[model samples]
Target: MAEQPETIKAFVKLGEFLGDYCQFAKGNLEFNEDQIKWLHKLDDLVARAASHNGWFTQGNILYAFEQWSTALKTDNLKKWLDQYDIQNSNPMTVAIIMAGNIPLVGFHDFLSVLVTGNKALVKLSSNDKILLPFFTEYLTTLEPLLLGYIKFSDEILTDYDAVIATGSNNTARYFEYYFGKKPNIIRKNRNSVAIIHGDETPETLSLLGEDIFRYYGLGCRSVSKIMVPRGYDFDNFYKAVYSFKDIIDENKYANNYDYNKAVYLMSEFKFLDNGFLLLKEDAGYASPIASLFYQYYDSKEYLDETLKRDADKIQCIVSSRPRRDHIAFGDSQKPALWDYADGVDTVEFLLKISNNN
Candidate 1:
């Protein structure tokens, strides 16, 4: 088994490498000769990645790298690992079935498996094929002991003791039926929402635009719905998010906007439009791309009860008031190493797998 501390060291180095690579992608590299050549290859890799998935714009992919670079810092990695007793004398191979909605979406599971001294048998999503491979190259090169510990396969997954599968609610039924015999963590579709107390400054609402438009609203962490005070006006909100009007310029997003808008119009659904985004009074959590669903609330008590009742469907609650599991505006996508998806701790699950073996 790879030593846990050594694995952490390798990831710290990887974080630094990613930081430098982000700078290179931003065209700020002066010259490192051999390293520059490697970065050029990565630049091409980013281009190919974008080609594979139109939603993966350069800015979004680079933002993913930047977030991972920050999360994998020496102190951050150490702090996250400190929470787990990761001395696995027997390391189990964990099968990770990932989703490709965003760049490197399956990485936390991959990282959890390896960081806990377990082998990772990964099944990459077709939409996000190249980004993780680049990280695999970096990590294995940094630590040769990890060479066999990490594996990626597109074929049928086999030879794994446990499973961690992420997919839509419909696909989750298939995963449970197939992988139910093994120790598993299965996740389904969940969306985030925001609460507007009608006290936010324009600057704060501007930051909320990042939560809405970043990644073109494809990530589960993206805010798709918001709860506002009854009779609340949205003039300030629209003005604040005007900075993100460029999002409609993306062809895929624009298509979604046009198609969904046409359907709403044909159906005679009352929705507010601002040329780039649609604000609809919807009680539903999931909203179509280029649209935001909102509901009116009368009291804070009702809001708390509603959120608690629908905890299973909510990923993150973007609010200014600090509370348990609530994320601030613009910060939902930038999760820490410990912030497990679906609120299930992946490290703890993998550690138990090692212990059981």
Candidate 2:
């Protein structure tokens, strides 16, 4: 395994480069000659990534880069690593089957594998093939030792000591069947929900719009449902989210909104529409894009009980209330480095696999 400090230093360098590039791209800072050349090249690459996948809009890809730029800071990496004994693990190749729900959605798993000194055999999602490989190649330029540690394969995955797979519920069953005998973390479909109060101001609800509209509500942590007090008036909710009305301007988002709305109208189902988004009264947690599923809750206790019962199907709860389990409004997408998906400790799993090997 490469020395731990060297790995951390390389990651921090990548983070700094990302941060600087972001500032330069936004015209907030001037880059040096070499940086200017490379950044202009990066601008072209970002456009190529957007072209490769319509969902990977330039803005969303940059947002993902900016988020990870902050997450990979030296202090943040140190703090997260301090939580476990992440050293001296016998190197093992980890096979990672990633989902392409959002930009860099599979990156945390990639980071977990490499930071723990484990080689990664990653099968990049077809929709997200461009960015991760670009960055990994960049990482090798900074730290040559990482060259052999990272492998992206479009063919069959083989010679892996452990597995980490993420996909929809049906694919999860297949993953379990094939990888169950090995040390693994197989993540299934999960959705996030928001618990809101009737008395809350529209200004507050507007912030919740970020949770629903960001990434077109495609991520597992995106709020797919909202539970409000019984008979809660939605007038303010509608007005608050009117600020995000421009989302309809995007071709893909508008197509979904138009199609889903047509289906609801043809089926004669009752729903609230505010020109851009749909609010349907439903019991399900996973709502279609451009729509939010909502339910009426009579009491806090009932909400708590229902949430507890549906824990496995939920990734995070969005609430303004003070609860350790709850993420603040608009903050679900900004998960910390330690916020492992499915509540499974990736680092610990890797350590165990290493020890067993």
Candidate 3:
């Protein structure tokens, strides 16, 4: 109960606004004088973001908004923060380096810094430059006190006590070399995978399509590969995912599909094709867009051991098994507030550094 109620209240109010925006986002929203202009501005932002980044489609942006709307509820916030004993700490500047693969991928880090009574100095990915600043504006409108706590930087980061950076394997090395001296959480690339047994129903396979295709498989949580039992029938899997074949209608995605298909053909690598998608028999976990790599497993025991051994490279396991840690199929994109990326707790990291300072 030591947590500030006003901060929580501000986020809850912002969540209500987002929910309303998602419901009647096409200029039909009802709001007071203060929020009316902001709502209009947000509508403009959706258009601008889509135009700025070809991968950030309007549907994906709206989906991100709706997901954040549901995640920012009072009850969910309380439950997520309940595990920690929050105490007053000297305010320090925490620099955040965000990723742009999917929409608003860095909001969690921004929220973690500000909610834990620290200032956030964010260096946004060029690919996702607009959404977070607009969100910060909305939060400051709700809680004027937060006006000083959030900042966006276009220059080299400086004057921060700690850093939280997310990027691919290459940038992670750079982050480590530069921010290693500071208290930091540097994240590298990790992809998700799914396990399939022969007995899955069509509904289960179809639902898995959402996991693979949402945000065009740009998210780290998206299933890039699958592990199936020996003699698995892919005809059923292809049929289940046929409904999403229209994904090739998008120009960027179709381009990638075509490019990758040509490369595979030129290399003379064998892969299965369904016009819109290519399935390859490979051992790697990270598959390119419009392509899925799969590996065959002979036994459940060996598959479990292999997954456990390579857990660090994996983000989430989508499976029908009752393992406590596995994410159920189709739920990978809908992570709860407590599902920390790379399994490293952000709140705890912030609190530890804050108390030390």
Candidate 4:
């Protein structure tokens, strides 16, 4: 295998190629109009695959590509590469246990492995098998070197240098038991939450809709619950989010929301109303359906404490506060290239493989 520095350069070139692919995919780069249209057609194919497999809608797929492009141009990927020492590592094998909550959710793991010259044996979620194969096929065309390194299997995998697994809280216990013997990055289901100060603009509130409803709210990064000031009006927020009502028809999601809503209302639960949403004064972070819902609190201090108490179950926290880089309300599933999932630094993980350390 090549030396570390040489390997890093190769990975950097691959990153650049992937970045270019995104532009081509988005029709934002210069190309024959026909070619651009064809590229977008490919995007549609992937979107259809996602929908058929119960992954997400077409809009969410486009949003995911947008975030991927942004991260490619930004310092995220470069920073990850440098921080992880991608160029100097040894040839390693990486086993990836992927998630199906959002479009291309497995892409980051693929990028990390290929850039660092590690072979990837991927166990694709039953809900997400379609898109990853299409993506890998296209990537192979772009860089023939990767054709053999990326393999998909349904069987249990072992004897790998490192492992990255994503699953629900219950499944995580099984992952830890099975894969924990190796250098592993195991992820459990964690909900994202948003904090509202009762002063958000309509546009901001509308964007929050994207955070909560996108992917039909299946992603770990999706904002499952919200924290709003006590007595906050639901009318303004509902009006802003109602525009997306057309996209909320995932039967599984609607059923969940509706079922929960009926239970709350029949039980005579106390909830604040904005005509379109319900704000129940609950203690937990997960929300029930039949409501564009949130848990109301009297103070930010209490919200902070609640979050802290459930830190292990929480992932990204969205806030308008300037200090936090939390994703906007609807941008949770649309992660940048460097936004490593499950809080694990993927590039650094790849570097360990490169160095055989």
Instruction: Provide the lDDT at 201 for model 3.
Output: 91
Using all chains and alpha carbons, the TM-scores for the candidates as numbered come to: 0.97, 0.97, 0.97, 0.82
lDDT tens digits, residues 6-61, model 4?
33344444445445556765566776775565466666776677668654665566
Give model 4's TM-score versus the native structure.
0.82
Question: lDDT of each prediction vs. the true structure?
Answer: 0.89, 0.89, 0.90, 0.69
Ranking by TM-score: 1, 3, 2, 4
Q: Candidate 3: deviation at residue 245, Å?
A: 1.1
In the range 1-357, model 1's lDDT, one tens digit per residue, is 223477888888888877888998778888689788778888999999999899999999899989989998977887888876678787788899999999999988988888888899999898999988888888888899999899889898888999999999999999999999999999999999998888899998888999999898888999999999998889988998999998888999999999999999999999999999999998889999999999999999999888899899999999866477788888989999888888899888887767777
Per-residue C-alpha lDDT of model 3 across residues 139-210, encoded as one tens digit per residue: 887789998888889999999999999999999999999999999999999999999887889998888998
lDDT of 2 at 122: 97
Where does model 2 exceed 4 Å of error?
1-4
TM-score of 2: 0.97
Error of 3 at 61 (Å): 0.8
The window of 10 residues in a row where model 4 has the poorest summed lDDT is 1-10
- The residue-by-residue lDDT of candidate 2 on 1-357, one tens digit each, is 223577788888888888887887788647688778767777788888889888888777878888999999988898888878776447999999999989999999999999999999999998888778878877898899999899999998889999999999999999999999988899999999999987667777788999998888999999999999988888878988899999999999999999999999999989999999999999899999999999999988999899999999999999877488898888989999999898998998998778778
Task: Determine the backbone clash count of candidate 4.
Answer: 14
Ranking by lDDT: 3, 1, 2, 4
